[model samples]
Target chain A: MKKLILALSTAAILSVASGAAQAATKVCFLYVGSKTDGGWTQAHDIGRQELENHFGDKVETVFLENVPEGPDAERAIERFARSGCELIFTTSFGFMEPTLKVAKKFPDVKFEHATGYKTEENVTSYNSRFYEGRYIQGKIAGMMSEAGVAGYIGSFPIPEVVQGINSFLLGAQSVNPDFAIKVVWVNSWFDAGKEADAAKALIDQGVDIITQHTDSTGPMQVASERGIKAFGQASDMIEAGPKTQLTAIVDTWGAYYIKRTQALMDGTWTTQSTWDGIVDGILQMAPYTNMPDDVKQAAMDTEAKIVSGELKPFTGPITKQDGTEWLKAGEVADDGTLLGLNFYIKGVDDQLPQ
Target chain B: MTLAEAILLTITTAATPLLLAAIGELVVERSGVLNLGVEGMIVMGAVVAFAAAQLTGSAYLGALFGMAAGCLFSLLFAFLTLTLVANQVATGLALTILGLGLSGMIGESFVGQRGVQLEEIAIPVLSSIPLIGNLLFNQDLIFYISIFSVFGVSWFLFKTRLGLQLRAIGDSHGSAHALGISVIKTRYLAVMFGGACAGLAGAQLSLVYTPQWVENMSAGRGWIALALVVFASWRPLRVLAGAYLFGAVTIGQLHAQALGFGIPSQFLSALPYLATIVVLVIISRNRRLTLMNTPASLGQSFVPDR
Candidate 1:
């Protein structure tokens, strides 16, 4: 009688599990840092929540935060695949190789990689054009700085950071040909103390304006304490430096995340590479604050022009670090050159790491 | 402030935490107990300090709480290695892993919150002096404590009777035990002191260093402090010099980049570590000095045989 009852209970549990499985799409995310990092990972996690809010019961979302970007990442991805995750999002540049490695093993599961270039049959690559907003920050820095020197704190000398540096300088040079920038590579993506020290070091060396490509509010807080102008990266960090933040470049991935998950649910998902910018609403500028009225107006004008295709930040007469011409007059930078950008522009004073 | 003055101030700020952590670990090793959990204790201190400060709105109370947390965390190591006689190296490593994971869990809610900055003490006439004024006079409480601790530790190690007993136990725990020195009790106190110092270093990071709490915010500084202890030959004064030298290299690299030096940042960022190794090589060449300073029984599990 006990065996018969146990068999009946097992059957009942299996039926309920199958019924729930048929009704929902299991989506998962692998984050390189903590969800409360207040920067890069937090921005991505916000997008994941938006997907849940949009689909509610039809979609089940789970995420593993602070997953290191190596063999551990591959393990996390494969675990998600084994647990019936129909789609997984690997949201970090270092996770590119790991995502590709796991995608090959789980041919049936779809994978989306943020800020990565590689793609497989099951893997799709997506990145927001953060350089677009960086250009606006450069313009603001150029117009407002008393010293005409902006200090840029970079995480690594990757193409992404290099692209932002070049875009910032080009934007600044357009307004003031003599605008100078000093770049400091902190060598890590998210150490608050190091980032703060880098900012202080820059400020001491006569940089009146501060900006960072690294994930943290350290530089912003330092800027606030020092009473210097700064721009935020990855997320709105005005709370960190309310009085000092000129503006922020916020990464909004909610629409993209929801759309991709919806596509998977509808069986229309396919491997693709997407590098969306301001026009696509992927990169957004926070409300212009802590700046003069005229400067704010100029920033808004530049934003509108970029959105309307009337202006391109990387257009024409650009020079490489070695004084070689990168783009002649009237020529806009192509996606290939921007994606693999390895050299600094002529005005940047620091050397790029090979 | 002049550019030179500003750079010096940054260097001082950078060096103090390393000095604090290294000095604390120096005492632990000098007691013949090598606690590898400096990194763990630091993070625990940082998180607890940040949380306590945020809750109480007093940075001092928060710092004390941080030191308490670190001391309590080290007691686990003391119990495992000193009482239960676990392998010192393995237990210390486990303590670090446990501390890191536990701190992250405890710090989850505290992330993104702005911390209260420790107020600096500006002396009247001293702060007004030119060039060296602000650099020397207008410093935070932790800076004064860190500098004072250096002298205090030096005196305790060389001049105090208890200090001699502690060092004696470190040199030969068995001999000290036969002499009725209570080896376990002395080592336990030494480990707790090390934990408190590591905790204070972490509080410096959260409350004074960046004025915020971020996960893993200690960011390998704990490991560097451990290296500093070895690099300084376990001496308090040498630890001060090594830490400041490291601090100078760190801030100096940024200055190099800001000046637009055409060197790769990877190479520049490696300067502090490279200097540490070079200094270590130089110091190790003097075998007698190193032998005199290093604890003979470091990293050994002490079984009382009672």
Candidate 2:
């Protein structure tokens, strides 16, 4: 009787384990900022919600926010894996190395990193080509600036921020040749006070328009106070200073997130780098507020051309910071030239920090 | 702002947080207890202050709540270290980890609320005195209170009978106990005082420093305050000087980066921390200095009956 009972218990346990393994999909998200910052993390949270709403009872999602990019991040990732998270998404550039490291430890788990350039068999990368939207904002900024000067509040000296600044300058120069962008490095991602101060200093220097890559609406607040027009950064910040906000580069990660989660549920999850722009609907533009009809029409024309592949934002005749032509007329910029943009355009006032 | 004015303003703002925290830790150490829980207390204070400020739309009330919450949390440490007679250092470290997790968990709701900042309190005649005006008179009320706390504490420690007894407990708990000074009670009071100061420091961070509650907003200021205790050899006035000097390093780094110094911003940030380590190394190398100023019964677990 004892032998029969032991065999029966073992079979029951095995069946239960199999059933658990066959349950609904579990996805985990780790954010570098809070879920309510109305910025990058908030955008991703929206995506997560969209996925959950679409997947309904078939998907299970868990998220940890404000996880710094370091050993702490590694510990969080390991904990998520131990908790049986089958698919994980880490949203930040600094998470690149740690995400890859943890992915190796959990080969069966699929990992996706945002704004990072690392990959493995189970790890893939994705980023929105945000420069495309900045180009459109720059065109409007150039049309409005009386001083022909714009302020660019940058978070860091990374390639991503550099690309945005360069693209904004290029778009401005297309409309106004002598426009100069004054760059101020705040060295922080979400410091509102510093962002506001940087904007004020630029305004003091006769900059009539401001563009910020920092993840806050503080810069726009300062611009509004000073009666200067400004472009919004990540997410719609119209409420911060509706009068001053020109347009925003609305990052639509929800579409991709919903798509990816659906793919994971359907067993079609694959590892590949996905760079989506306006053409693919990942990088979008908010409506132009207080902009003239002609300015709005111009931006719309650029948008249409981009979506239809009739015009490329980074078209040729581009010059390096050292006055050397990187892309001559009628030549398209290659990934190498655009990826390694380490210099200022012709009209930038700030010296590039070494 | 002139160089002198800016330097003065920076010192006061920088010193307020450290000075407040160090004063509290000084009291804790004087009672033969070393509480590494300052970090946790400060973070809690930041979250509590931000929450209160957002609810009431008043920075002052937020600060009060912050201090009260901080003191309440410190009571837990006091109970464990003083009542339970557990190892103070270990308990303190545990309290910090608990406080960090708790603060982060509770601070989730304050991710984007703009805090009400305390306005600068400019004295009628003093604020108009050019360089002196900006330096000494153009600061918020917290700076004034921080400076006064230094002297207030010095008087309490050196002049008052209670202060003498507290020092006696640190110097030789057995004698103090024989003389009828309650070691546990004295240590508890000191620890609570430390908690109050740490709370104020945290309030400064969330209400004034960035005017928003960011996760780990206190950064390592609590640890820095602990180091300032060692750097100052535990004297109240010297603690003040050390706190201001450290603050100078913080401001100097920003100015250095702003001036386009070739050094990376990361290195400049690490400089102040590196300076603290160097100060510790030098003090440690000088054995005489260490033996002269360290509290006799620091980090000691005191059991009255045993």
Candidate 3:
């Protein structure tokens, strides 16, 4: 009788485990631009593929590309929900509201938004600390640039981009106190011609080193053509400018995507916000090139220190554009201030667009 | 390069594409066809040109392919509006939408791939001259072509008999038809010319401007070219002037920002469009020029009395 009871309990547990394993997790991704955009969207797509590779047949993934941010996004998300997507990842900041709206309607479905702030019971936000990589590029720019002037091509004046600019300047100032940065806001995320034109304009004005927060390889191509140095953003752009690309700040979303997908599969998914940096492997630096060994070593060291929390890009003794002390001496910047960063720090030469 | 020289060179680069597209559209509008699909055609030209250049390893061949693609795309519009009697405005809009979507699909694999840049043609003796040489002789083949197009278009429209017939059709299709001129045939040729020009403009973008493929790389240059046609009052020379003027404003704003003039970047970015509006207002104030230069049957669908 005792052996029969144990056998019955083992059979029940095996059935439950197999049942959970057998149900495939249907995951959907909504992208703001083409998957082959060669930048941000491309990075996310790569991560999605990595997720697929990691999970194999246990997971099924679907995605809709070029979904606009507003009402159309809501429709896309709702369609995914209606199609029985158990979890959806809206991979652009503009889809925050739509993701939340769909999450509310489909309470059982999980939603993840990238580079967003809002969250609910079923909605989670995730972002990588891209500024950390920008900080390292700043250091390299300050050292390598002949004119000590770097140009930054920004897509928008949002906190995210502003944070990167500030961190970059801070990194440059650390290496060269006299280092100056000129910023041009193209007011767009992916205008290749405008970005190239902006790069040329900056170079013409004595900017030798260029960096862009935009989504195209245009600036890097311009840098290569003009014989100037530049850093790539979001993806490794060495192919775009083999001679000019010093290093690239690559966004690695694969691990996070895998983690979240695993959580969903394990039935342990919950609403939470995650802001990870180099330590968590969300932000990665491409192999340093077009620089001396020592310079490359120094960049790698700085990256290591950032990951180890030994160096903070936005330490105090920082002055805002309006001549106000933002952080006290020796005090690192807090998340709140960083999240709402809108003003330029002291060494930047250009005015922040209001 | 001196700041002035740099600025001038930048302006030339900026203006050439607009000049090319505008010159072509000028002819189309002169033939009484309104095609707002220049943007789509330009983008199609850019991707096709990039792909061809990458595959063939020759920039010149890439440019030819680009022009051919544009001509082909414009042929679709001609078939719809001219033969099928579709509404020109709606058909043009549909063409733009279709072109944009189709280019994106076609360009998916070409993205992130760099193409060979069109080499600059430096006329040895002439290019040795100071500012003028660098401005004129030391330019790429496309730049020379764009300038030649200006003179060629001006001569064709004002000096040539075919040009007069095209203008007549634009002014009054009915009068031209009754005068024994084939209105539909002339319009078809003009539209094809415009498409070819728009394609060359796109090729200049991918092969010379940035020398790479990116979705929507043409940005709003097509619209700007369209606006340039209106700002120039449909004249070829004025189109050249307006394009360069807009280019100067564009580069000037960047200079202003780099100089740290304390102006907000947003306003600096807005300067180009603002200048466009101001120039348009100033030019449109002279209503006689606009009316005299304007095509009377512009945008009107000509269903020849069949």
Candidate 4:
């Protein structure tokens, strides 16, 4: 009698476990920095939460935050795959090759890579068009800058950052042809102290408005403390700088996350390259504040134009930094040129670090 | 204020944290203990300070809590290395790993939160003096503590009897033990002091430096502080100078980049470490001084034979 009862209980527990597993799709994520870094990784984390909210019991979300790039990333991805994660997301450009390698090892486990080009049969790539917002920020900076010069704190000289610089300059030039910008590269994506120091240096060097491509809100806080105008990135930083933030380019990835998770659960997930923009609800601008009414209206108009396909930020009668003509009048740059963008436009003051 | 004045003010802010941490580590090393967990202690302090300030609505209380947290954290290291006779190097490294992970967990809630900035305390009249006035006389509370700590540490190391006893213990712990000196007790006090200084430095980071709580906000500054002690040849005054030199170079490189100097950003970013070490190395080339200041029994585990 005892043996029969024990066996029956064991069978029941196993059935429940299997039922739970079959009911919920396990989705895992690997991040390059802390989930609360207030920048790139933080943005992804917010999106992850959206996945949980949208799917409820249909999906289970797990994440390994602060996972470094390279070999460790491979181990982390493989660990997730081995643990029966049906879908995995590797966020960061450096995770590209590792994601591919791990995806190959676990073909059954679907993978998504953020901000990369390569996509395998089981791996997909997606990124937001952040430069679209940069163009708006530059226009705002151009209009409001009292000194006619702006300080730009860039994280790295990657094509993404380069595109921001060029697009910003073009937008600023549209407002005031002679408006100039000084660029300072802090190298790392998020070191608050260094980013703050960069902001101070730019201000002391005579730039009235400050903007940063770095992950931390350090620069924004500095601009606030110094009583200067600035913009936020990745996430809304109005809390950090109530009076200082002109407008921020916020990465609102919740909509995309819900869409993807729904598709995954519906058995319609497919590998694709996605570079969504403001129109797709993937990227958005924080409310225009700390600016004149006309400037705010102008910014909104610019946003409308970009979203309506009336203004392409990279279109140009633009000159390279060396005074050589790259694009003739009204020549819109292809995605290929923008992806490989490394050169500075004509009026940028700082040299690009190779 | 002129741009130069602003730059000078920033230099002080940058250097104060390093100076505070290095001076404390110098004492620890002087007492025969090599606590490499300065980074760990500092990060814990930053998170703790930020959290306390957020809770209490007072940055001062947060700073006090931060220092206490660091001191208590070091006691764990002291117990393992001094009492349990664990390898000091291994234990110290472990302490750092533990501190980083623990602080990350503790600071999880504080992440993305803006910290209360420790406002500058301007000295009446003195702050108005040309050039040096704003840089020295007007600054945050931690800056004053950092300067006083340097003077206090230098005077204590050279003039005080207890300081001599501690140095004797560092040089030859067994000999100090034979003389009936409580080597473990002195080392504990020294280690705790070092931890407190590192904590205060961290408080400065979260309160005065960037005024925010992020995981690993120290960003290797503790390791840099550890190096500063060696670069200063364990001299308190030189540590002050070394810290400033590093801070100046770090700020200078940023200015240079803004000026469109065209230097490679990576090389420019590394300029602080290179410049600080080179200057300190050149000044401390006198091997006798460096050798004399270094504790002979540093990093050695002490087992008392009662």
Candidate 5:
């Protein structure tokens, strides 16, 4: 009787699992921070939601939040792949190697790593052109800054972050030739305390405008408290600094998520390195707020020109830290060079960490 | 404020939390009880403080509630390690792990909400003075409590009879026990004090430090405070200097990076740890200094004799 009962329960479980598997594709995500971190991870989680919304009953989305980026990430990714997840997304740059390692084990499962460089047949690298929005922020900072100086709190000196610093200065320089920006790397992407201190340090040094590449609203709140203008990153931080936030670079990955998940469902999923930009709708700017009408109009004009392919943020008349010309006038920086950007452009008041 | 004054003020702000938590841990360690759960207690304090402040609209009330939560949380550790006669180190570690996980859940809804920051209280004449005035006199309530606690702790540990008894108990609980000091009772109070201080420190993090609750927002600061207790060799005065030094190095590196000093940021980011290693090595080299302040029975569980 006991053996018969056990057999029946096993068959029941197996049937339910198999039935559910056929009904919906299991898409899993690994987050480096909590889904409610109010910054980077939160933005990615929002994108994850788009898959469920767009695919509806065809897709069953699940995520493991606050997965540390190391061997732990490898375990989490492998666990998801083993559990019949057709696709997995590792949403952190540090999870690059881990994702690759796990992808090798699960040859059939597709993997997507955000802001990572390495890729394999099963693994793909995907990120948005966040620097495009930084350009608009710089332009607005140039027009609206009370000190003619802005502060940038960076999170590591990766090519992506360096690109943001360079693009912002370039945009600011376009409007105000004498504009200077200070860069402070908090090292880690999060840690609200360190981010706040970095912002305070810059403000004390006379920067009237503040921006951050780190995943926290700490800098924005600091700017708000100090009565200085600031820009938000990853998500709309108008809630964090309702009046102080001039605008924000909202990372809209939903469209890309929908497209990629749809490809997987359509059986056309090929490993592709995607670096979408403003025109691709992978990222966008939060509404320009707390800035003058002229600055807002100017920012919109720059965004329009970028979308129209008339203005490139990495265009010529730019110089490296050593005063070497990076781009000749009217020369737009190639995607390859920008993707591997390791040097800081001139007017940036911080040394590039190699 | 001038640049120097501003930097100094920032350093003071940075050091206050470390000072408070470390000082509290110092008392607990002095009573021969090692509670590794300082991180856990501090985080709970942070979450509770933020939640209270958000709900009550009073940062002070929030701070009080946070401190109480930290104190209450510490009692869990106290009951297990002190009363249950469980392994102190294991219990302490469990407390921390429990604190981190529990605070994350408690603070889940509070995430993304801007917290009510504890406003600075400027002393009239003192705040008006040049340089040091604004740096020291004009600060948040937490800063005042932290600075005052260091002095109060220093006096309590050295100048008072109960302080000496606590030290005696730390050095030789059995001997103090024979002499009629309630070993368990003293340790209990010491642990509670430690918990309260850690809680207050956490309150500082949410209310005065960053002004919001981030999950694990204590951010290993409680662990730093633990290291600081050892770094100071269990001395109250040294903890002050040590915490401020750590704070100074941390803020100084950021300033250097901001100023584009041509130094690599990875190297700048490691400055505080490097300074800590260097200071610790120097302090350890002085055997007499370490021997004088080291708690003899620290981490050893004591069962009171009937």
Candidate 6:
């Protein structure tokens, strides 16, 4: 009688285990850099961590980091598909073409690309409207600056960087009419020395405030040492320099990552574009300790207004860097104009690099 | 500082890494062995240096490890060129590919982890000297070392008996062999020196220059270094000038865009590379000039029997 009871319990456990195995959901993440870089990949890794936290044993996750953004990316996606990944996320702009190529071959697999524009039946794209936060930070830079000169450590000459710079200038000029943003393009996304040197050169030229789109906190460290103020690029770099860091444009991919993974597990996954901004809470302001109270209060008010759709930072009366009227006063720019922003506004010191 | 001053500063820093590597390659080529694996060696050095620095928290030790790693990889080239007597160009190409793959694999863990950066050791009055002062002396120790190496190499090649012998071997291995100069030994020394220099360049990249290792971060700098050697016409001082010129080209692009002073950004971005090609064209304009300095035994099979 004892043997029979034990045998029955073992059989039941095995059946349950089999059922759970069959119900498991698998997800894959492809990264262009190491997750530890504290840059693009780190943010993506945070999102992946959220997926794992929310789903627990219901979902399985794997990632391939430091994959090149071109042909290699497509190969990585194909590998994931062959390895039974139910969903794959390719994170990088250059991965767009490769992601689409792999998506077509793996129709059964769901694909979500970060910072890409392509979409397919099984593929979707999502990117933060980071410029929204840049515009806000620009407002702060304008208000707090004793020097009219603001140094911008630019990463690339891509459309994304262009958009951010333009939005930043527009926001700054709205507050400080005399503000001039002197940009220094390092042309690399993650070179600390180059970023630091660019910041120093700007400071050498009498610019007191700085901002960077580069990944490393070396620039912030330099700024702190030089007794100048600066804003963080992608992540909150307060730890890198608490004194100099006025604020940061934080990329909070966790909520969206968790939400999307859960959707996949629940069988509600669908291709879609996500252009969330301050309203949806994906882009948030890091705690503003260095900012003055008045400046802080103004930023808070602007944030609230932006979230409520009551304020449009890129409103008209905009003129190009070359003095061309881009928008009449009170004229709001459509999504298309902003999407294809090919020029800078007035008061920008450098022309857009070809 | 004017735009020119800013551009000059950027160029000097940018050329530091390339100049170190090219000088090493110059020595290697002078010995009549072409080691095309500089890119690979550089990557290996960077990854090894970064990993060592991260573990020990010592930038100096990290640099040593990088040089050691580069030397270790150079043995493959030496073995192939010296013992097996393989085709120099092909062996060098294989070395580059191998170094790239191996370094990429090893660099995976070191990626994104910041290593310690080199501090500038500036001389008092030298660093304070006007425009030229900031542009030249205010740089880190590596820059001074690179400049010193140009004179060092010039003296070694012209004033010293050993330098004369090395040049003789490069000019004609047969005649040098007849004079009883150990062909294999001289070649090995040159290659090893080249390897060490490549390692230093890699160390500078991860330690002083960037302070981080990204996969394949050498990013064709090695190829450009090779071109600089050709542009320098195998002269050390000229190589320095070529490197600085390339550096200026690179920084000039960014400066034009930064001050948004009015040039098309993309065109500016491509200017440095275009400038390199143009310079190469001009250097080769007089076919006789290249023919005069071209090593007679370059890329040639140097078998004792031949």
Clashes of each: 0, 1, 0, 0, 0, 9
- C-alpha TM-scores of all predictions: 0.97, 0.84, 0.95, 0.97, 0.96, 0.87
lDDT of 5 at A70: 88
Candidate 5 on A1-354: residue-level lDDT in tens?
999999999999999988977889889899988888888888889998987898898999999998987899889998999998998988888899988988988899999999887889989899889999999899998888778889999988888999999889988888898888899988888889999999999999989999999888899998999999999999998988999999999988889888888898899999888888899998999999987788889989999998997887898878887899989988899889988999988888777788
Model 3 steric clash pairs: none
Candidate 3 Cα outliers beyond 4 Å, as residue runs: A1-22
Worst 10 residues of 6 chain B by lDDT: B251-260
Best by DockQ: 5
Candidate 6: where are CA atoms >4 Å away?
A1-21, A190-197, A221-226, A239-242, A322-331, B1-7, B47-65, B84-117, B122-139, B174-179, B210-217, B299-306
Candidate 5: list runs displaced more than 4 Å.
A1-17
What is the C-alpha local distance difference test score of candidate 1?
Answer: 0.92
Instruction: Report how far residue B89 has shifted in candidate 6, in Å.
Output: 4.7
Candidate 2 fnat reads 0.09
lDDT of 5 by residue, B1-306 (tens): 688887888888889889999999999999999999999999999999999999999999999999999899999999998899999999999999999999999988998888898988999999988778878888898999998999999999999999999999999999999999888888889998899999999999898878888888888898899999999999999999999999999999988888879898898888888888888999999899798889999999898766
Task: In candidate 6, list every pair of residues with a backbone clash.
Answer: A349-B259, A350-B259, A350-B260, A351-B260, A353-B265, A353-B266, A354-B264, A354-B265, A354-B266
Candidate 5 chain B lDDT trough over 10 residues, lowest sum: B128-137
Model 1, A1-354: lDDT tens per residue?
999999999999999999998799999999988888889989999999989999999999999998998999989999999999999999989899988988888899999999899988989999988999999999999899888889999999999999999999988988898888899999999889889999999999889999999988899999989989899998998878879899999999988999999999889999999999899888799999999999999999999999998998899988887899989999999999899999988889788878
State the displacement of the C-alpha of residue B167, model 5, in Å, after optimal TM-score superposition: 1.0
How well is each residue in B229-255 modelled by candidate 4, as lDDT tens digits?
Answer: 988878899899889988999999999
Model 6 over residues B229-293: C-alpha lDDT tens digits?
Answer: 88888889999988888887776555555555666655665777788788879989999988777
lDDT of 4 at B113: 79
The TM-score obtained by model 1 is 0.97
| Prediction 5 TM-score vs. true | 0.96
DockQ of 2: 0.17
Which pairs, if any, clash in model 5?
A: none
lDDT of candidate 4 over A1-354, digit per residue (tens): 999999999999999999998799898889999887777888888989998988888889999998999999999999999998988989999999999999998888899999999999999999988999999998998899888899999988899999999888888989998888899998888888889989999998899999999888889889998899999989899988999999899988778878887788898999999999999999999999999999999999999999999999988799999999989998999988888898988889988998
